[model samples]
Target: MVASKRNRVLAGMMLAIGFAALRSAPAAEVAAVLRAPDFKLSDQYGQSLSIQYPRESACVLIFADQRGSSQVEGWVRPLYSRYQGRVTISGVAELSSVPSALRTMIQGIFKKTIQFPVMLDWTGRVSRQHEYRGKAAAVVIVDPQGLILHRETGKAAVEALERCYEVLDGLVRTEDETPPTAPQDGPAVEQAQRQSRQNGAGGAVRQSDQAKK
Candidate 1:
């Protein structure tokens, strides 16, 4: 009788543990799904821009301060070479610390240096919203609806780039594949192209090789 009573207690404890785990799992998942905050800021050319989510392709936002800006090219070049059409890549300069008086000079410098549009964050509000790390560049990947799929902060070293690649590989589809029932013209075709590039055909393989070099 004592053995049976002990068995009952053990079973109750196991059930309680299982229930606790189940309760916590969803909270963790919800916490992980951080949605990107939307805002408009002028680019290097002084043209205003904002990330309109639920876009045709996934978006990559690279946030950097003066120190972190040095690492931007290491991440951007390879990523652009391989996933240019597959993803929308943009840069955000964390220039909130710059004095208001020097803003025009800074913008001019950016225009001269960067060929692409880099949204200038004069107020720092966007940087804070995105949790910009001042020490290292923060690479954030957001899906169509602006849900942040992946984020990492550090130098764009090979290993770090590989990790980012892995996240992107999971999110983006290859160029050739298409859904059977979906129409070819609109977002469905775009969605179909967002498949895994590693599993894609020869052209994709060539692009991947080029990115490594």
Candidate 2:
């Protein structure tokens, strides 16, 4: 009789715990969205670049520390090949740990080695604002209005890459499916076709370069 009473009490406790979890689930789901922070920083080439919200195209920011820098190309090359025009991709290097004296040398090295612009975060202000992971590369996808839609940090694993691609694919498809409010003239149509061809050709060149490497 006593054992039966104890089991009943245990069951009641479990039921109450389950009810509490269910009650909290909706609150967790309704958490506020995260927005990307805007900042201006000089690239390796000493060119100024700024990230402003509500941009014309979606943006991808790749953040990496010295250790994580090696993994960046894995994410950048493929992303550039696939979404060059449809998305704006940028690289942010977290360099707060570097000595002040070596900063210029580091910038020069980046300029010589990297074909594209790499924004140098000397004080790590931008990286911290973006919640960058120091141990691995952090890839953030932001919508036109600057809301962070997806974030992946770590080695560019196949599954993570695929998830990023799915988000980009959906965004591009939605944009393509939207009906234009006004009819385009001949030049506009021709320009779009030319851009598409250019993108395809660029992707081919990148793939070939990767194969050669």
Candidate 3:
């Protein structure tokens, strides 16, 4: 009879512990700010970057193409120039999105000319997920809170550049702000198509999970 009582007590203790464990289990984190999908990419300088999407500062993510590179570069490059110390501005070179044969020329010659940080998206995963209608030449301007303030097709026009600046004009502080890069308006769409024909960037490059941390 005493052994039976002890067994009952042990069973009751197990039930109580299980109930407590269930109660103490963590809840899923509710985001306080609009967040972008986390991305781990290396810069041209082989520096690893950790991007916590819902960051405190605003950022401009420009996925540039070689054809519309001059125009898009003209626009987003200024953000880095103006807010070098403040904002998270970068031009992610969608190199992997291009033909593997042309990667050398673009990365070696064209991309090398840029003054700003033109990151290498080797797998093309990030660019593909956010590609604008299969067009990789795109730009996304986000606010300090991480809300997408403005976005444009990779080969959008001069007016789109204005919309982008209009969003940033009120929020950021820049001591040496400059104007947009260039104004290649006509045949912009055609140029984008022609450029993409040359670059056959595709497939999800496999990366190890350890790369995340």
Measured by lDDT, the strongest candidate is 2
Query: Candidate 3: which pairs clash?
Result: 74-181, 97-201, 99-199, 99-200, 137-154
Q: Tally clashing residue pairs in candidate 3.
A: 5
Query: Clash number for model 2?
Result: 0
Please give, for residues 29-104, the per-residue lDDT of candidate 3 as tens digits: 2223444556778775557775566676777777765554665656655666666667777666666656778766
The TM-score leader among the candidates is 2
Candidate order by decreasing TM-score: 2, 1, 3
Q: What is the C-alpha lDDT of each candidate?
A: 0.82, 0.87, 0.63
Which is the winner by lDDT between candidate 1 and candidate 3? 1
Per residue, candidate 1 scores C-alpha lDDT tens digits across 10-64 of: 9999999999998754211112688888788999897999888767788889999
Candidate structures ordered by lDDT, highest first: 2, 1, 3
Error of 1 at 132 (Å): 1.0
Residue-wise lDDT of candidate 2 within 137-189, one digit each (tens)? 88988888888888887777787788889888988777678666896779889
lDDT: worst 10-residue window of model 3: 200-209
